[model samples]
Target: MAHLEPLDPKVDSIRILTLLPRVDNPNSKELFCKLENRTLASKPKYEALSHAWGPGQATDTIFINGQKVVIRPRLHDALRSLQTGKGRSLWIDALCINMEDTKERNDHVNMMSYIYSRATKVLAYLGPSHSAFNKADMKEMGESYHYFSERNCQLISKSIYWTRRWTIQELIQAKEIRFHLGKGYFTLDNRFNSLSNASNGSWLDDHLERIENHRNNMHSHLQQLEVLLEMFKDLECEDTRDKIFSLLGVADDTAQELIEADYDVDYYQLYASLIDYHQSASPLQCRSDLFRSSTYDPEPWRENWQGFDVSIERSVRVIAFSNLVQKTLNSAVNQTPIPESLSLGDPIIARGVIIGSVMSIGETYDDYVSSWESNKKWKALLESTYKKDKDLAKWRENDAAFYQEMLKWDHSEVAAIQSCDTTKSYGYRESQDDEHITREALDSVTEGAQPRRFLGTKGLMGFLPPGAKEGDQICSFWEACFGVVVRKLSEDRWMIVGRATVSKESLTPAVTESVYHDALNYGTENTSYSSLLSRTGDEFWAKQKDLAYEALIFFKLDIPTLQKLTA
Candidate 1:
């Protein structure tokens, strides 16, 4: 027999070894010894090897047997602790990749699977495994890993080289050994006691117990290896077609859905650009960093559009406010009470209810903004409407007790609005009368108040008292309605009349011209504004406006007005 030293000399604590069969061929044995004694005489030129290789080359790293080595980072730490100041040999896959050694790298890639299989105590240093492994940690988790990556997974090829794929079959076979199959084994601590208990003449128990424990540990290690193998199988094969198909199929659907939604145009554009780049990618050529670009910022467009939206929304709020006010005025105008009909205070109650409803639109919007973290424009719209309603609540005639009672009804309406999940009855109830009233208010306030172009008006029936304070210049009765009539009614000339709610405010001469201008220039707002004027003989206006107003009484004003109007 030829005298030879073992490939590595770092072994002291480990007693176990894998037996390799001697081959008949002298060259095969030489190659096997070379593979086994993977340690270099000196540091090999890695840069030359890496430079010679083209893309898609097989690569691997070799570790010498009996070498005190760390497979991964924490294992390096653990192995260092085992060393006593002597240079402990460590075989790291990263250091051995030989990036510059193209021929060696290519040859090593094909042998990686075999090299890893023969390794003793392959340390899977997943994370800093010098400490206990917490599988849940995001940074350290090796729960699942991509096998053949070209970009971020630069070290993946080396990792596969160190795994013992062939030994997994042996480990699976080891699971059925007597010690594991039966309860014939003791734990590591109990081995000594078990051996002492068994007589020297009957050493079967001690041997069987030790074998069982080894089998159990081997079984556990085998399971982990099987999972790791699954990551590497077919990774470097030509049949990468299936993987491409699987990934690309779902990606196409998601891209199509995003495009169809048309919600974020810039995001979709960026996604499409990335998809186009990926479809024509070469092996390992797809760089993850290239796709990490942000979509074009829509901040400028958002800012500009927000201004228009806010102006429109403000117009809507003003319309709603004017509507509430007009309803109060109309209610005060038609204060004729009926017996067995609901009290004047009942219509007084409805005015508050509708006011609460409109305010609740503001409240619902506020809640939406808060819940969705919507932008400031939406928040401002809700907040402004809320503030205006609060201001309106301060004014009153001589109905202090009635106003207090109305507050309860208003609260109930608000509660109902809050409970409503849909837009239909969030603030305004879904009644034919309420719908007509809202539409009429939107039309009328937008129309008749052009010079000081009010958004809209609300109507009620009772007449206002003549000695009304400016604050009490709001109608508060069964027949009363309210609206955000334009501020064009000059402070000096606008006079409060009966019940202190009616106001005779003169319009500027530009009222008709402004209404026409707005209608012609601004489509919806201006057209609706012009329609509010009551032409002396325009029977269509008279009928349509009156019919709409009368219908609103059924839902919002007092039960008497509803009964009379419907009657």
Candidate 2:
């Protein structure tokens, strides 16, 4: 009906050039028009018949005007074959094969996902889409042949293998942490490894001092010195005497230096009392006791030799100094207990008292408890597990109900899926009605009691309640549906924290099924698919929250821990 215009020779030359191997052909201005008309033209009833063939015989193509675009030989042959077949025209790349051309191959390879996305029915070809296979074989094979064979070796070399290795291989091949092993057991990057192995640096001196002060005390140091002296008493001869003198500061030089200087204690009895005192005190007690015992031993007064009153005075002075030192030592041994409130029924307060009391004796609570409870049968079991596994104690100590609920919910959801009958649920009344009709027919013939007509379930049958059905309560109910709130404390974000189950019912059926049925319909029709997923999303998150709350009640965690988490 419209006038035909003559085509320019220059335009015709350009159109022909577009189909060549390396020609840069701009996209047709009318390409969008063809795309938009695709759905409209692709309806099954309006499909063209090839005298005997179905819509499947046609090849889908983007006709710029009306001329057939001259693509490569393989694709051209495929299009021609599709034009004669009974199968619906699927414009996917697997159907069109220009396997010889690298450039065309690369372009198509990138668009594979898009090709499947746009297809009327993505004929996920199993082996071959056109292959005449039986239904059994097709089902078994799956729709694997639908994927286009990728021959873009450059893309594979550059993008897939090289890029993937650069991103992920290092992490996958990295070393694991074995803290119980030697110091260099775990190795990550060179920097991290170096950081771990670095010295007990100058920055740590203050911390070291604090730690030393915490454990070091005058009375314990004195006790240790006595033990060390007893150990040295078993050593032999003049060498032992010199070594003892050097250790106790009676000698000027260390044993190694004295050996180098050829120093030896010839008159061992002159320092006999010093050696005896050093032998009495331990190693820890030796250094502190050195000055008073050996270095500053005063001689007896001249009057003491003649048995005069001066002898009594010298004895009295000695006794007074000894008494003073003994009193100071005794006071040091009796340390003050850390002040703390022993509030009744408070587990933290009880645990604190236990921890503080035990920590006074040992380096850590674990070390102290391991020693204190070693004889118990429960200790054997705990050690057996704790030695082999780190998480074992945590697993046992955790609320048993947390895992129990997880397994319970997992099985319940699985069972719910297995028991579901979609057709029956969707058409419950119709199916029941048909069943009753068939039963009545059979009953009349057999002369049994007449079968009754099927009646709908008691609660819901499109019947309105005594009042309105949809209102604020219903909207509020939907709003409160299963979801989790991720609350942020410092921020003013009011997140509905934790997993919640705000369904029509939980663990039990609702008292009124009418509200429940309406909610179910609303959920199925109105809610997004993400809102309905079973696990790991809003619904599952909400459920987890509720389960956590149940665990808190069941486990009876202390108020402080609970308050801290919720806050």
Candidate 3:
């Protein structure tokens, strides 16, 4: 064993751990290691090792610079597998970086993108071969296999190594990638040949194809950021900040200056800065396709768009707002009604169904800004006034009764009342006969009151209901647009928390049925709301009769406007 020294940060160089060939004794406790120093400026040739660090408690002793050092058991296995007769020089992050030194770790991480890109080759250690693999069976099968079984493919695809956040950048930046599965080693270019005699060839091939697809998609720097965010959303890191910092170097050139690796800054602050940077740098293109549906017309705002200026403190608010607006517009334009067969329930009256056309589309930043400001002011007033005056609640209850009375009158009578210009106060008018009051007259008498936007429904702006998510669909009827219900919310109620986007392209009956069934399956198996519904007992079921029947009603309702839009 050789004694290793601290890496010099001043020099743009890295230390590589060279694992010597195994000795004669198979059960030998001792292992040899030699430290090789290389600098990027000199363009040194080395292979980088990428592997997942398993449980910290399961450690193995390895010789580094003539000193015994503890490393993860998996790393030890990787080193043993890579060792050759002539020995091998490898840059493994765990061994190469001084884990005890925070500054050194940061410096080394900063150069990781460059280090991997410049490496002669990258060896991905996927630990032992899966037990399902048999070497001889694959040799006979040859290239005749059309597809690998999904279960077999998942063995490699779902491995912990692939789940790591850091390995993504490492694997992507490498000049060349080779996989080490147990004692077997193979490059992607010749992976088929290496797998010719293995039973798990198809599985390995599928995994390789996925990796190749990821690599190809990451060719664009901006696209890489998008991929990174999606691919690593569930991936874990000890320091949450590293979640963003680790990908900075591999991200677009624009991102380099936008965010800097700082241990002092909180992860949320880093995330906010990243969102702000992305919004400013790529305003029109959102990172997730969930927010960028085909029906959204960015072209209308393209010329006058001033771009989103998301603040670090308000990043979540901005993102939520943007998502809501974009999703509503998308769902409204691409409405899809349920099939007729799904509807078996009797028609039930739906109150407050506002119906209207989109009178004019706002196509500028100023339009959005003005609308947002006005809404904020109105919200503030409502909150402040309601908090101060308890009488407002009583007034609203009385107004609701008056509105119900107006609803009972004939259309001509209602029209006459709507056209009236009476200025009598609501309180004063309420003192008189109920038949004498008009809707317009009631409106004029109320202090600080404005006519409801949906009162007549001549010009209405569609919006998502509270708690709507990406996959929820919106259905348009002759009179109004409605959210489709996947499951029953109550015995007499169904949930349509948000509008779902329907694809414009037409599907075959079978495919359409399959999609609908899948949605139902998801609702039943995955949703928390579905779980609550299940526990509602016999009373809930008796009232609902068949909840699915009610769900079908919402899905099957005919919407001419939506049909034409899809058509």
Candidate lDDT scores, in order, read: 0.25, 0.22, 0.46
Residue 433 displacement in candidate 1 (angstroms)? 60
Candidate 1 structure quality by residue, lDDT tens digits, 63-128:
234332223333222222222223223333333444344444433433332233343323332121
RMSD of each: 29.4, 42.6, 21.4
Worst 10 contiguous positions by lDDT, candidate 2: 350-359
Residue 267, candidate 1: C-alpha displacement in angstroms: 22
How far out, in Å, is residue 503 in model 3? 21
**How would you encode candidate 3's per-residue C-alpha lDDT over 175-254 as one tens digit per residue?**
78876766665556555454443455464465456557657756443344544554455565555556666676666644
Candidate 2 lDDT (Cα, 0 to 1): 0.22
Would you list the clashing residue pairs of candidate 3?
1-66, 2-65, 2-66, 3-65, 338-555, 472-499, 472-500, 473-500, 474-500
Show where candidate 3 strays beyond 4 Å. 1-4, 27-29, 140-152, 189-210, 217-227, 253-255, 284-567
Sort the predicted structures by lDDT, highest score first.
3, 1, 2
Model 2 misplaced stretches (Cα beyond 4 Å): 1-36, 39-66, 80-87, 92-120, 124-567
